[model samples]
Target chain A: MIRHIVLFTWTDDATDEQKATVTAELRKLPDAIPELRSYTVGPDAGINQGNHAYGVVADFDSADDYLVYRDHPLHQAVIAEHIKPILAARAAVQIEV
Target chain B: MIRHIVLFTWTDDATDEQKATVTAELRKLPDAIPELRSYTVGPDAGINQGNHAYGVVADFDSADDYLVYRDHPLHQAVIAEHIKPILAARAAVQIEV
Candidate 1:
Protein backbone atom coordinates (compact mmCIF):
# COMPACT_ATOMS: atom_id res chain seq x y z
CA MET A 1 0.00 0.00 0.00
CA ILE A 2 1.05 3.55 -0.59
CA ARG A 3 0.41 5.76 2.41
CA HIS A 4 -0.23 9.27 1.11
CA ILE A 5 -0.23 11.92 3.80
CA VAL A 6 -0.88 15.64 3.42
CA LEU A 7 -0.74 18.42 5.98
CA PHE A 8 -2.31 21.86 5.58
CA THR A 9 -2.00 25.09 7.52
CA TRP A 10 -4.92 27.40 6.82
CA THR A 11 -4.47 31.07 6.01
CA ASP A 12 -4.63 33.43 9.00
CA ASP A 13 -7.79 35.15 7.75
CA ALA A 14 -9.67 31.96 6.79
CA THR A 15 -13.11 31.71 8.40
CA ASP A 16 -14.77 28.85 10.23
CA GLU A 17 -17.30 28.57 7.41
CA GLN A 18 -14.55 28.09 4.84
CA LYS A 19 -12.80 25.42 6.91
CA ALA A 20 -16.09 23.57 7.34
CA THR A 21 -16.66 23.71 3.62
CA VAL A 22 -13.22 22.24 2.96
CA THR A 23 -13.89 19.41 5.39
CA ALA A 24 -17.25 18.58 3.85
CA GLU A 25 -15.86 18.66 0.32
CA LEU A 26 -12.96 16.38 1.25
CA ARG A 27 -15.29 13.92 2.96
CA LYS A 28 -17.06 13.51 -0.35
CA LEU A 29 -13.90 12.37 -2.13
CA PRO A 30 -13.65 8.65 -1.23
CA ASP A 31 -17.16 8.05 -2.52
CA ALA A 32 -16.47 10.01 -5.69
CA ILE A 33 -13.12 8.38 -6.50
CA PRO A 34 -12.68 4.64 -6.98
CA GLU A 35 -8.93 4.72 -6.58
CA LEU A 36 -8.94 5.36 -2.87
CA ARG A 37 -8.70 2.35 -0.58
CA SER A 38 -9.13 4.24 2.67
CA TYR A 39 -9.20 7.91 3.68
CA THR A 40 -9.20 9.97 6.87
CA VAL A 41 -9.25 13.74 7.31
CA GLY A 42 -9.59 15.99 10.34
CA PRO A 43 -8.56 19.16 12.20
CA ASP A 44 -5.72 19.47 14.68
CA ALA A 45 -6.75 18.76 18.27
CA GLY A 46 -4.22 21.39 19.51
CA ILE A 47 -2.12 19.01 21.57
CA ASN A 48 0.97 20.18 19.73
CA GLN A 49 1.39 23.92 19.26
CA GLY A 50 3.81 23.33 16.37
CA ASN A 51 1.40 21.15 14.39
CA HIS A 52 -0.41 21.90 11.18
CA ALA A 53 -4.07 22.92 11.41
CA TYR A 54 -5.42 20.01 9.35
CA GLY A 55 -4.31 16.80 7.71
CA VAL A 56 -5.44 13.90 5.55
CA VAL A 57 -4.10 10.39 5.22
CA ALA A 58 -5.26 8.20 2.40
CA ASP A 59 -4.14 4.75 1.31
CA PHE A 60 -3.96 3.54 -2.24
CA ASP A 61 -2.95 0.18 -3.70
CA SER A 62 0.12 1.66 -5.34
CA ALA A 63 1.73 4.91 -6.39
CA ASP A 64 -0.02 4.80 -9.78
CA ASP A 65 -3.41 4.40 -8.12
CA TYR A 66 -2.62 7.36 -5.85
CA LEU A 67 -1.77 9.47 -8.86
CA VAL A 68 -5.15 8.69 -10.39
CA TYR A 69 -6.91 10.07 -7.34
CA ARG A 70 -4.55 13.03 -7.17
CA ASP A 71 -5.28 14.10 -10.76
CA HIS A 72 -8.99 13.28 -10.85
CA PRO A 73 -11.21 16.12 -11.97
CA LEU A 74 -13.26 16.12 -8.75
CA HIS A 75 -10.08 16.37 -6.67
CA GLN A 76 -8.78 19.19 -8.86
CA ALA A 77 -12.08 21.02 -8.54
CA VAL A 78 -11.94 20.92 -4.77
CA ILE A 79 -8.30 22.17 -4.70
CA ALA A 80 -9.00 25.02 -7.06
CA GLU A 81 -12.30 26.06 -5.51
CA HIS A 82 -12.25 25.26 -1.80
CA ILE A 83 -8.60 24.68 -0.81
CA LYS A 84 -6.42 27.00 -2.87
CA PRO A 85 -8.07 30.23 -1.83
CA ILE A 86 -7.71 29.64 1.92
CA LEU A 87 -4.47 27.66 1.97
CA ALA A 88 -1.39 29.01 3.77
CA ALA A 89 1.14 26.15 3.58
CA ARG A 90 0.93 22.57 2.35
CA ALA A 91 3.27 19.61 2.78
CA ALA A 92 3.03 15.94 1.86
CA VAL A 93 4.94 12.66 2.01
CA GLN A 94 4.18 9.32 0.39
CA ILE A 95 5.61 6.06 1.67
CA GLU A 96 5.34 2.50 0.49
CA VAL A 97 4.31 -0.03 3.09
CA MET B 1 -9.03 6.76 18.37
CA ILE B 2 -6.55 9.57 17.96
CA ARG B 3 -4.46 9.74 14.82
CA HIS B 4 -1.13 11.37 15.53
CA ILE B 5 0.84 12.49 12.50
CA VAL B 6 4.33 14.03 12.51
CA LEU B 7 6.42 15.28 9.60
CA PHE B 8 10.15 15.93 9.76
CA THR B 9 12.76 17.63 7.59
CA TRP B 10 16.31 16.67 8.41
CA THR B 11 19.07 19.24 8.73
CA ASP B 12 21.12 19.87 5.57
CA ASP B 13 24.26 18.62 7.24
CA ALA B 14 22.73 15.33 8.33
CA THR B 15 24.37 12.29 6.83
CA ASP B 16 22.74 9.23 5.25
CA GLU B 17 24.02 7.18 8.19
CA GLN B 18 22.18 9.50 10.55
CA LYS B 19 18.93 9.16 8.60
CA ALA B 20 19.17 5.39 8.65
CA THR B 21 19.83 5.45 12.37
CA VAL B 22 16.76 7.60 12.95
CA THR B 23 14.61 5.15 11.02
CA ALA B 24 15.98 2.14 12.86
CA GLU B 25 15.52 3.81 16.23
CA LEU B 26 11.93 4.84 15.53
CA ARG B 27 10.98 1.36 14.37
CA LYS B 28 11.83 0.12 17.83
CA LEU B 29 9.21 2.28 19.61
CA PRO B 30 6.07 0.18 19.08
CA ASP B 31 7.49 -2.65 21.15
CA ALA B 32 9.07 -0.29 23.67
CA ILE B 33 6.03 1.89 24.34
CA PRO B 34 2.74 0.31 25.36
CA GLU B 35 0.65 3.35 24.47
CA LEU B 36 1.34 3.06 20.79
CA ARG B 37 -1.36 1.01 19.12
CA SER B 38 0.18 1.25 15.68
CA TYR B 39 3.12 3.06 14.06
CA THR B 40 4.57 3.65 10.61
CA VAL B 41 7.65 5.66 9.66
CA GLY B 42 9.58 6.16 6.44
CA PRO B 43 11.52 8.52 4.21
CA ASP B 44 9.62 10.87 1.92
CA ALA B 45 9.58 9.28 -1.57
CA GLY B 46 10.41 12.61 -3.20
CA ILE B 47 7.24 12.79 -5.26
CA ASN B 48 6.72 16.32 -3.98
CA GLN B 49 9.66 18.65 -3.56
CA GLY B 50 7.71 20.89 -1.20
CA ASN B 51 7.14 17.95 1.15
CA HIS B 52 9.12 17.26 4.30
CA ALA B 53 11.85 14.62 4.28
CA TYR B 54 10.11 12.09 6.50
CA GLY B 55 6.94 11.45 8.47
CA VAL B 56 5.35 9.22 11.06
CA VAL B 57 1.68 8.36 11.61
CA ALA B 58 0.85 6.65 14.88
CA ASP B 59 -2.48 5.58 16.30
CA PHE B 60 -3.48 5.64 19.93
CA ASP B 61 -6.63 4.90 21.89
CA SER B 62 -7.01 8.48 23.18
CA ALA B 63 -5.31 11.84 23.52
CA ASP B 64 -3.92 10.93 26.92
CA ASP B 65 -2.61 7.63 25.62
CA TYR B 66 -0.82 9.43 22.82
CA LEU B 67 0.77 11.72 25.38
CA VAL B 68 2.02 8.69 27.28
CA TYR B 69 3.89 7.59 24.19
CA ARG B 70 5.06 11.12 23.47
CA ASP B 71 6.69 11.45 26.87
CA HIS B 72 7.87 7.88 27.28
CA PRO B 73 11.49 7.61 28.34
CA LEU B 74 12.35 5.41 25.40
CA HIS B 75 10.77 7.87 22.96
CA GLN B 76 12.53 10.78 24.62
CA ALA B 77 15.82 8.95 24.42
CA VAL B 78 15.43 8.38 20.69
CA ILE B 79 14.45 11.99 20.09
CA ALA B 80 17.25 13.48 22.10
CA GLU B 81 19.92 10.97 21.08
CA HIS B 82 19.03 10.70 17.41
CA ILE B 83 16.22 12.85 15.99
CA LYS B 84 16.60 16.28 17.59
CA PRO B 85 20.18 16.79 16.58
CA ILE B 86 19.48 16.02 12.91
CA LEU B 87 16.06 17.66 12.63
CA ALA B 88 15.80 20.93 10.79
CA ALA B 89 12.02 21.31 10.92
CA ARG B 90 9.08 19.41 12.37
CA ALA B 91 5.31 19.66 12.17
CA ALA B 92 2.61 17.50 13.54
CA VAL B 93 -1.22 17.10 13.81
CA GLN B 94 -3.40 14.98 16.04
CA ILE B 95 -7.07 14.33 15.37
CA GLU B 96 -9.84 12.19 16.78
CA VAL B 97 -11.23 9.54 14.51
Candidate 2:
Protein backbone atom coordinates (compact mmCIF):
# COMPACT_ATOMS: atom_id res chain seq x y z
CA MET A 1 0.00 0.00 0.00
CA ILE A 2 1.07 3.57 -0.54
CA ARG A 3 0.32 6.52 1.71
CA HIS A 4 0.42 10.21 0.91
CA ILE A 5 0.31 12.44 3.95
CA VAL A 6 0.00 16.19 3.71
CA LEU A 7 0.16 18.58 6.65
CA PHE A 8 -0.91 22.13 6.06
CA THR A 9 -0.94 25.38 8.02
CA TRP A 10 -3.26 28.11 6.91
CA THR A 11 -3.41 31.80 7.75
CA ASP A 12 -4.79 32.47 11.22
CA ASP A 13 -7.50 34.66 9.74
CA ALA A 14 -9.24 31.74 8.06
CA THR A 15 -12.60 31.02 9.71
CA ASP A 16 -14.29 27.83 10.96
CA GLU A 17 -17.15 27.87 8.43
CA GLN A 18 -14.66 28.30 5.59
CA LYS A 19 -12.67 25.32 6.81
CA ALA A 20 -15.82 23.20 7.03
CA THR A 21 -16.49 23.93 3.37
CA VAL A 22 -12.92 23.06 2.47
CA THR A 23 -13.13 19.84 4.42
CA ALA A 24 -16.31 18.78 2.67
CA GLU A 25 -14.82 19.64 -0.71
CA LEU A 26 -11.69 17.64 0.03
CA ARG A 27 -13.62 14.62 1.27
CA LYS A 28 -15.43 14.41 -2.05
CA LEU A 29 -12.17 13.80 -3.96
CA PRO A 30 -12.09 10.00 -3.79
CA ASP A 31 -15.30 9.73 -5.82
CA ALA A 32 -13.84 11.95 -8.54
CA ILE A 33 -10.43 10.28 -8.72
CA PRO A 34 -10.38 6.54 -9.33
CA GLU A 35 -6.78 6.18 -8.20
CA LEU A 36 -7.46 7.60 -4.79
CA ARG A 37 -8.34 4.46 -2.82
CA SER A 38 -9.09 6.23 0.45
CA TYR A 39 -9.15 9.74 1.84
CA THR A 40 -9.25 11.06 5.41
CA VAL A 41 -9.25 14.73 6.31
CA GLY A 42 -8.97 16.24 9.79
CA PRO A 43 -8.72 19.52 11.62
CA ASP A 44 -6.91 20.65 14.75
CA ALA A 45 -9.68 22.74 16.30
CA GLY A 46 -7.73 24.28 19.21
CA ILE A 47 -9.00 21.58 21.59
CA ASN A 48 -5.49 21.12 22.96
CA GLN A 49 -4.09 24.60 22.60
CA GLY A 50 -2.62 23.82 19.19
CA ASN A 51 -4.05 24.73 15.81
CA HIS A 52 -3.21 23.11 12.51
CA ALA A 53 -5.26 24.20 9.53
CA TYR A 54 -5.71 20.69 8.17
CA GLY A 55 -4.28 17.23 7.70
CA VAL A 56 -4.99 14.96 4.74
CA VAL A 57 -4.00 11.31 4.79
CA ALA A 58 -4.61 9.28 1.67
CA ASP A 59 -4.11 5.62 0.87
CA PHE A 60 -3.51 4.25 -2.60
CA ASP A 61 -2.65 0.96 -4.21
CA SER A 62 0.51 2.19 -5.90
CA ALA A 63 2.61 5.26 -6.54
CA ASP A 64 1.40 5.49 -10.14
CA ASP A 65 -2.16 5.73 -8.89
CA TYR A 66 -1.04 8.36 -6.43
CA LEU A 67 0.66 10.24 -9.23
CA VAL A 68 -2.51 10.14 -11.26
CA TYR A 69 -4.42 11.47 -8.29
CA ARG A 70 -1.85 14.21 -7.82
CA ASP A 71 -2.06 15.35 -11.43
CA HIS A 72 -5.83 15.09 -11.76
CA PRO A 73 -7.56 18.29 -12.86
CA LEU A 74 -10.13 18.23 -10.07
CA HIS A 75 -7.28 18.12 -7.54
CA GLN A 76 -5.71 21.03 -9.33
CA ALA A 77 -8.94 22.99 -9.16
CA VAL A 78 -9.13 22.45 -5.42
CA ILE A 79 -5.56 23.56 -4.94
CA ALA A 80 -5.86 26.64 -7.11
CA GLU A 81 -9.29 27.81 -6.07
CA HIS A 82 -9.23 26.86 -2.40
CA ILE A 83 -5.96 25.71 -0.90
CA LYS A 84 -3.26 27.87 -2.48
CA PRO A 85 -4.81 31.17 -1.48
CA ILE A 86 -5.48 30.30 2.15
CA LEU A 87 -2.52 28.08 3.03
CA ALA A 88 0.60 29.53 4.53
CA ALA A 89 2.75 26.46 3.87
CA ARG A 90 2.29 22.74 3.27
CA ALA A 91 4.42 19.62 3.72
CA ALA A 92 3.83 16.35 1.89
CA VAL A 93 5.20 12.84 2.36
CA GLN A 94 4.64 9.97 -0.09
CA ILE A 95 5.78 6.50 0.87
CA GLU A 96 5.00 2.83 0.42
CA VAL A 97 4.22 0.25 3.13
CA MET B 1 -5.24 16.34 22.23
CA ILE B 2 -2.36 17.84 20.31
CA ARG B 3 -0.84 16.13 17.32
CA HIS B 4 2.78 16.69 16.53
CA ILE B 5 3.53 15.56 13.04
CA VAL B 6 7.03 15.66 11.66
CA LEU B 7 7.97 14.71 8.12
CA PHE B 8 11.63 14.37 7.26
CA THR B 9 13.73 13.56 4.20
CA TRP B 10 17.14 12.16 4.86
CA THR B 11 20.15 12.16 2.54
CA ASP B 12 19.91 9.43 -0.09
CA ASP B 13 23.22 7.99 1.02
CA ALA B 14 22.04 7.11 4.52
CA THR B 15 21.95 3.32 4.94
CA ASP B 16 19.16 1.00 6.08
CA GLU B 17 21.11 0.02 9.17
CA GLN B 18 21.39 3.67 10.08
CA LYS B 19 17.67 4.11 9.52
CA ALA B 20 16.83 1.07 11.65
CA THR B 21 18.91 2.36 14.50
CA VAL B 22 17.27 5.72 14.17
CA THR B 23 13.83 4.16 14.15
CA ALA B 24 14.52 2.18 17.29
CA GLU B 25 15.79 5.28 19.02
CA LEU B 26 12.82 7.31 17.92
CA ARG B 27 10.38 4.66 19.09
CA LYS B 28 11.87 4.82 22.53
CA LEU B 29 10.98 8.51 22.88
CA PRO B 30 7.59 7.97 24.48
CA ASP B 31 9.17 6.14 27.37
CA ALA B 32 11.50 9.02 28.07
CA ILE B 33 8.90 11.74 27.61
CA PRO B 34 6.00 11.45 30.00
CA GLU B 35 3.58 13.55 27.99
CA LEU B 36 3.73 11.63 24.72
CA ARG B 37 0.47 9.76 24.22
CA SER B 38 1.29 7.83 21.09
CA TYR B 39 4.08 7.35 18.54
CA THR B 40 4.15 5.98 15.02
CA VAL B 41 7.08 5.84 12.61
CA GLY B 42 7.17 4.56 9.04
CA PRO B 43 9.47 4.27 6.03
CA ASP B 44 8.81 4.97 2.35
CA ALA B 45 11.09 2.02 1.33
CA GLY B 46 10.85 2.48 -2.42
CA ILE B 47 8.12 -0.09 -2.99
CA ASN B 48 6.11 2.05 -5.40
CA GLN B 49 7.32 4.22 -8.29
CA GLY B 50 8.26 7.01 -5.87
CA ASN B 51 10.39 7.09 -2.72
CA HIS B 52 10.22 9.05 0.50
CA ALA B 53 12.79 8.75 3.28
CA TYR B 54 10.57 8.36 6.34
CA GLY B 55 7.42 9.59 8.06
CA VAL B 56 6.61 10.14 11.75
CA VAL B 57 3.24 10.81 13.33
CA ALA B 58 2.94 11.48 17.06
CA ASP B 59 0.06 12.32 19.38
CA PHE B 60 0.42 14.44 22.45
CA ASP B 61 -1.90 15.58 25.23
CA SER B 62 -1.32 19.31 24.92
CA ALA B 63 0.80 21.88 23.15
CA ASP B 64 2.86 22.45 26.29
CA ASP B 65 3.67 18.76 26.44
CA TYR B 66 4.53 18.85 22.75
CA LEU B 67 6.79 21.83 23.39
CA VAL B 68 8.55 20.01 26.20
CA TYR B 69 9.02 17.00 23.94
CA ARG B 70 10.55 19.32 21.37
CA ASP B 71 12.94 20.72 23.96
CA HIS B 72 13.61 17.49 25.81
CA PRO B 73 17.29 16.66 26.15
CA LEU B 74 17.00 13.08 24.88
CA HIS B 75 15.03 14.21 21.86
CA GLN B 76 17.63 16.90 21.28
CA ALA B 77 20.39 14.35 21.54
CA VAL B 78 18.72 12.12 18.96
CA ILE B 79 18.36 15.04 16.57
CA ALA B 80 21.91 16.29 17.01
CA GLU B 81 23.52 12.90 16.84
CA HIS B 82 21.33 11.06 14.34
CA ILE B 83 18.88 13.27 12.49
CA LYS B 84 20.40 16.70 11.88
CA PRO B 85 23.63 15.52 10.27
CA ILE B 86 21.89 13.18 7.82
CA LEU B 87 18.68 15.07 7.03
CA ALA B 88 18.22 17.05 3.82
CA ALA B 89 15.07 18.83 4.92
CA ARG B 90 12.51 18.40 7.69
CA ALA B 91 8.93 19.63 8.10
CA ALA B 92 6.83 19.68 11.26
CA VAL B 93 3.17 20.45 12.10
CA GLN B 94 1.74 20.80 15.60
CA ILE B 95 -1.95 21.31 16.21
CA GLU B 96 -4.85 20.61 18.55
CA VAL B 97 -7.51 18.00 17.92
Candidate 3:
Protein backbone atom coordinates (compact mmCIF):
# COMPACT_ATOMS: atom_id res chain seq x y z
CA MET A 1 0.00 0.00 0.00
CA ILE A 2 0.98 3.60 -0.45
CA ARG A 3 0.51 6.11 2.32
CA HIS A 4 0.26 9.75 1.32
CA ILE A 5 0.85 12.28 4.07
CA VAL A 6 0.45 16.03 3.79
CA LEU A 7 1.06 18.72 6.36
CA PHE A 8 -0.28 22.24 6.05
CA THR A 9 0.25 25.57 7.78
CA TRP A 10 -2.28 28.30 7.22
CA THR A 11 -1.65 31.96 6.46
CA ASP A 12 -1.95 34.45 9.29
CA ASP A 13 -5.21 35.76 7.88
CA ALA A 14 -6.87 32.35 7.84
CA THR A 15 -9.84 32.18 10.16
CA ASP A 16 -11.27 29.33 12.17
CA GLU A 17 -14.18 29.06 9.75
CA GLN A 18 -11.83 28.69 6.80
CA LYS A 19 -9.82 25.98 8.53
CA ALA A 20 -13.00 24.19 9.49
CA THR A 21 -14.21 24.43 5.93
CA VAL A 22 -11.00 22.88 4.68
CA THR A 23 -11.36 19.99 7.09
CA ALA A 24 -15.00 19.51 6.18
CA GLU A 25 -14.25 19.46 2.49
CA LEU A 26 -11.38 17.04 2.94
CA ARG A 27 -13.48 14.69 5.06
CA LYS A 28 -15.83 14.16 2.13
CA LEU A 29 -13.08 12.97 -0.20
CA PRO A 30 -13.04 9.26 0.81
CA ASP A 31 -16.66 8.83 -0.17
CA ALA A 32 -16.24 10.80 -3.36
CA ILE A 33 -13.19 8.80 -4.39
CA PRO A 34 -13.46 5.09 -3.87
CA GLU A 35 -9.79 4.28 -4.29
CA LEU A 36 -9.06 5.48 -0.78
CA ARG A 37 -8.40 2.57 1.58
CA SER A 38 -8.30 4.83 4.63
CA TYR A 39 -8.32 8.58 5.16
CA THR A 40 -7.77 10.89 8.11
CA VAL A 41 -7.76 14.69 8.20
CA GLY A 42 -7.82 17.16 11.07
CA PRO A 43 -6.21 20.16 12.73
CA ASP A 44 -3.20 19.68 14.95
CA ALA A 45 -3.76 18.48 18.49
CA GLY A 46 -1.66 21.36 19.87
CA ILE A 47 0.46 19.05 22.00
CA ASN A 48 3.75 20.45 20.83
CA GLN A 49 5.06 23.82 19.70
CA GLY A 50 6.19 24.68 16.16
CA ASN A 51 4.06 22.02 14.51
CA HIS A 52 2.10 22.48 11.30
CA ALA A 53 -1.56 23.34 11.88
CA TYR A 54 -3.21 20.55 9.96
CA GLY A 55 -2.55 17.14 8.42
CA VAL A 56 -4.02 14.68 5.95
CA VAL A 57 -3.14 10.97 5.70
CA ALA A 58 -4.58 8.79 2.99
CA ASP A 59 -3.88 5.23 2.04
CA PHE A 60 -4.33 3.46 -1.28
CA ASP A 61 -3.50 0.06 -2.72
CA SER A 62 -1.04 1.39 -5.27
CA ALA A 63 0.54 4.47 -6.81
CA ASP A 64 -2.09 4.44 -9.57
CA ASP A 65 -4.87 4.64 -7.00
CA TYR A 66 -3.02 7.51 -5.39
CA LEU A 67 -2.88 9.24 -8.78
CA VAL A 68 -6.61 8.77 -9.12
CA TYR A 69 -7.12 10.55 -5.80
CA ARG A 70 -4.63 13.26 -6.69
CA ASP A 71 -6.24 14.04 -10.03
CA HIS A 72 -9.84 13.52 -9.05
CA PRO A 73 -11.94 16.57 -9.84
CA LEU A 74 -13.49 16.69 -6.40
CA HIS A 75 -10.08 16.64 -4.74
CA GLN A 76 -8.80 19.34 -7.08
CA ALA A 77 -11.86 21.46 -6.37
CA VAL A 78 -11.23 21.23 -2.64
CA ILE A 79 -7.63 22.34 -3.03
CA ALA A 80 -8.52 25.22 -5.30
CA GLU A 81 -11.56 26.52 -3.47
CA HIS A 82 -10.85 25.72 0.17
CA ILE A 83 -7.16 24.97 0.80
CA LYS A 84 -5.15 27.16 -1.55
CA PRO A 85 -6.37 30.51 -0.35
CA ILE A 86 -5.35 29.78 3.24
CA LEU A 87 -2.27 27.68 2.62
CA ALA A 88 0.96 29.20 3.82
CA ALA A 89 3.17 26.13 3.66
CA ARG A 90 2.70 22.55 2.54
CA ALA A 91 4.90 19.46 2.82
CA ALA A 92 3.84 16.15 1.36
CA VAL A 93 5.23 12.65 0.85
CA GLN A 94 4.01 9.33 -0.47
CA ILE A 95 5.69 6.31 1.09
CA GLU A 96 5.36 2.63 0.36
CA VAL A 97 4.17 0.47 3.25
CA MET B 1 -5.24 8.52 19.32
CA ILE B 2 -2.73 10.99 18.00
CA ARG B 3 -1.09 10.46 14.65
CA HIS B 4 2.25 12.18 14.26
CA ILE B 5 3.34 12.80 10.70
CA VAL B 6 6.76 14.10 9.77
CA LEU B 7 8.28 14.77 6.36
CA PHE B 8 11.97 15.17 5.65
CA THR B 9 14.08 16.49 2.79
CA TRP B 10 17.72 15.55 2.95
CA THR B 11 20.75 17.69 2.24
CA ASP B 12 22.39 17.25 -1.14
CA ASP B 13 25.46 15.60 0.30
CA ALA B 14 23.61 12.85 2.17
CA THR B 15 24.53 9.42 0.87
CA ASP B 16 22.31 6.40 0.31
CA GLU B 17 24.13 4.64 3.13
CA GLN B 18 23.27 7.49 5.52
CA LYS B 19 19.60 7.28 4.57
CA ALA B 20 19.57 3.54 5.02
CA THR B 21 21.11 3.95 8.43
CA VAL B 22 18.50 6.50 9.35
CA THR B 23 15.74 4.13 8.33
CA ALA B 24 17.36 1.28 10.24
CA GLU B 25 17.59 3.45 13.34
CA LEU B 26 13.99 4.66 13.06
CA ARG B 27 12.62 1.18 12.58
CA LYS B 28 14.04 0.33 15.97
CA LEU B 29 12.05 3.02 17.77
CA PRO B 30 8.77 1.09 18.07
CA ASP B 31 10.56 -1.65 19.89
CA ALA B 32 12.55 0.74 22.03
CA ILE B 33 9.67 3.04 22.89
CA PRO B 34 6.71 1.05 24.10
CA GLU B 35 4.40 4.05 23.79
CA LEU B 36 4.24 3.73 20.04
CA ARG B 37 1.08 2.02 18.82
CA SER B 38 2.06 2.00 15.17
CA TYR B 39 4.96 3.36 13.13
CA THR B 40 5.82 3.64 9.46
CA VAL B 41 8.95 5.11 7.91
CA GLY B 42 10.41 5.06 4.42
CA PRO B 43 11.74 7.09 1.54
CA ASP B 44 9.24 8.77 -0.73
CA ALA B 45 7.57 6.64 -3.40
CA GLY B 46 8.31 9.42 -5.95
CA ILE B 47 4.82 9.27 -7.37
CA ASN B 48 4.36 13.02 -7.17
CA GLN B 49 6.70 15.79 -8.16
CA GLY B 50 7.98 18.18 -5.46
CA ASN B 51 7.07 15.88 -2.62
CA HIS B 52 9.36 15.58 0.39
CA ALA B 53 12.04 12.88 0.22
CA TYR B 54 11.16 10.89 3.35
CA GLY B 55 8.27 10.45 5.73
CA VAL B 56 7.34 9.05 9.16
CA VAL B 57 3.89 8.33 10.50
CA ALA B 58 3.54 7.22 14.14
CA ASP B 59 0.50 6.59 16.23
CA PHE B 60 0.02 6.60 20.00
CA ASP B 61 -2.84 6.12 22.36
CA SER B 62 -2.68 9.74 23.50
CA ALA B 63 -0.64 12.90 23.37
CA ASP B 64 1.12 11.84 26.57
CA ASP B 65 2.23 8.61 24.94
CA TYR B 66 3.53 10.61 22.00
CA LEU B 67 5.50 12.85 24.34
CA VAL B 68 7.10 9.81 25.90
CA TYR B 69 8.23 8.65 22.47
CA ARG B 70 9.37 12.13 21.63
CA ASP B 71 11.46 12.47 24.78
CA HIS B 72 12.80 8.95 24.88
CA PRO B 73 16.58 8.88 24.81
CA LEU B 74 16.79 6.18 22.14
CA HIS B 75 14.56 8.10 19.78
CA GLN B 76 16.51 11.30 20.44
CA ALA B 77 19.76 9.48 19.72
CA VAL B 78 18.48 8.39 16.32
CA ILE B 79 17.62 11.99 15.45
CA ALA B 80 20.83 13.40 16.78
CA GLU B 81 23.19 10.78 15.38
CA HIS B 82 21.48 10.01 12.10
CA ILE B 83 18.66 12.29 10.92
CA LYS B 84 19.84 15.74 12.00
CA PRO B 85 23.13 15.43 10.15
CA ILE B 86 21.39 14.97 6.80
CA LEU B 87 18.12 16.83 7.29
CA ALA B 88 17.69 19.86 5.07
CA ALA B 89 14.00 20.47 5.69
CA ARG B 90 11.45 19.01 8.08
CA ALA B 91 7.73 19.52 8.50
CA ALA B 92 5.68 17.82 11.19
CA VAL B 93 2.20 17.79 12.69
CA GLN B 94 0.30 15.82 15.32
CA ILE B 95 -3.38 15.36 14.72
CA GLU B 96 -6.20 13.71 16.64
CA VAL B 97 -7.50 10.56 14.99
* Most accurate candidate by DockQ: 3
DockQ of candidate 1 is: 0.76
Q: Tell me the spans in candidate 3 whose CA falls farther than 4 Å from its real position.
A: none
Q: Per-residue alpha-carbon lDDT of model 1 for A1-97, expressed as tens digits? A: 8899999999999999999898899999999998899898989998887789998999999889999998999999999999999999887899877
lDDT of 3 at B21: 99
Candidate 1: misplaced stretches above 4 Å? none
lDDT of 3 at A14: 99
For model 3, residues B12-96, the per-residue Cα lDDT tens digits are: 9999999999999999888888899999999999888899999999999999999999999999999999999999999999999
DockQ of all predictions against the true structure, Cα-based: 0.76, 0.28, 0.94
User: Per-residue lDDT tens digits of candidate 1, residues B7-81?
Assistant: 899999999999999989999999888888989899987766688899899999999999999899999999999
- What lDDT, from 0 to 1, does candidate 3 have? 0.95
Give candidate 2's error at residue B80 in angstroms. Answer: 1.0
How would you encode candidate 3's per-residue C-alpha lDDT over A1-97 as one tens digit per residue? 9999999999999999999999999989988999999999999988888999999999999999999999999999999999999999999999999
lDDT of 2 by residue, A7-77 (tens): 77787787777677778788789899988887767775443334345777777898888888888888888
What CAPRI-style quality would you assign to candidate 3?
Answer: high
TM-score of chain B of 3: 0.98
Which number leads on lDDT? 3
Instruction: Tell me the TM-score of model 3.
Output: 0.98
Q: What is the C-alpha lDDT of each candidate?
A: 0.91, 0.75, 0.95
